[model samples]
Target chain A: MKFSARNVFRGKVKSLKKGPVNSEVTIEMPGGLEMVATVTTQSAENMGLAEGAETTALIKATQVMLVSE
Target chain B: MKFSARNVFRGKVKSLKKGPVNSEVTIEMPGGLEMVATVTTQSAENMGLAEGAETTALIKATQVMLVSE
Candidate 1:
């Protein structure tokens, strides 16, 4: 399943916050901005994603539909 | 930016193939097993995805790892 999203940023996994059914993964960009993504523990392990690991964050800018204050 | 894939199948956009940089979205599954995605016709009219609408195909199945002939 290859999705065609723009490779917004490539960064290193800065932290992994555990959650009930999912985990919050934060990637630290070169410019210092952070992008947070949510993935299942299963996915995290399967992707071998962990703090300090290199990864790219693909984002369908449009899918980012909204943001709330 | 949210990415917590695993929605697997919930299709409708039955065809829209036109590629160069990217564009090859085909989603049609109802136990029928057909999942192919590759978007960008400006993301098919900014997610106004044609051909019957109703979208949902988030797959992180180990990134579909690999495939060969």
Candidate 2:
């Protein structure tokens, strides 16, 4: 699929935790860099996300915040 | 709009820089929080991203990385 976001990472699904409205998904990238994604339960179900499944984490730079003290 | 991904932040557009293929957008959130987003020039144009424009930065948790040192 074509997307406008510049940051995309390949990952493997590590775990899935269901919430009321969203489901928390853990994705393990290379070098053990793990990321979490909260998606709608429907979306999670549609993607068939499960343990050991391969997926991608698409990110927009605007979504990232940097803090310095 | 119905998006499967969770994590949304409301902000005003701080700046928009056009690149060869992609455009960099800076968004300022509440309480001085700022975030940067890189999108395709076409996408930028489609979204009408510009200075002072209000926008929402949609992020999936899977897109965020954490490091503990």
Candidate 3:
């Protein structure tokens, strides 16, 4: 999909944990790097998300924050 | 900081584009990989974020996705 967000990563859904309002999703990339995302419970169901399903991890650079030690 | 979500990348601030409400920030990782993020104007200024500054791009795996062709 054509998206304005610059970071679009390919990953497979490794696991899913549902909560009252939000769901925790883990996607592991080809490089073996893992990322975790939090989405609303409704959104997860709407996406028909399931374990082992291939999906795109869309991260808006704007949502990224910089921290220095 | 100890963050619950995974995928914390180290990078340098490449540029910043400010809008009325949101600001676009670009960070370049060590391998020359570039990632972009969007933040609020207030948050950007509050953080005193500027170009050429070192920062951490925090991405939750949940924010990431996988897509197949």
lDDT, candidate 3, A1-69, per-residue tens: 597768877778899899999888887766566678888888788888889888877776656665665
Q: In candidate 3, what are the lDDT values of residues B25-68, reduced to their tens digit?
A: 88877656677888888878888889888888887655654444
Model 2 lDDT per residue over B1-69, tens place = 334565778899999999988888999999999999878897788777779988888776557899998
Off by over 4 Å in 3: B11-33, B38-54, B60-69
DockQ, each predicted model: 0.18, 0.22, 0.47
Q: Write the per-residue lDDT of candidate 1 for residues B1-69, one digit (tens) a residue.
A: 234465556778888777655677788889767787877776666566777676778776445677699
Clash count for each candidate, listed in order shown: 0, 6, 21
Q: What are the lDDT figures for the candidates, one per model?
A: 0.74, 0.82, 0.77
Ranking by lDDT: 2, 3, 1
TM-score: model 3, chain A: 0.90
- What are the per-residue Cα lDDT tens digits for candidate 1 across A10-59? 79999998776678899999989999988887667767777898887878
**Residue A66, candidate 2: how far off, in angstroms?**
0.8
Off by over 4 Å in 2: B1-69
Docking class of 3: acceptable
The C-alpha TM-scores of every prediction are 0.56, 0.54, 0.65
Q: Pick the candidate with the highest lDDT.
A: 2
Q: Please give the distance, in angstroms, between residue B57's alpha carbon in candidate 2 and its true position after superposition.
A: 14
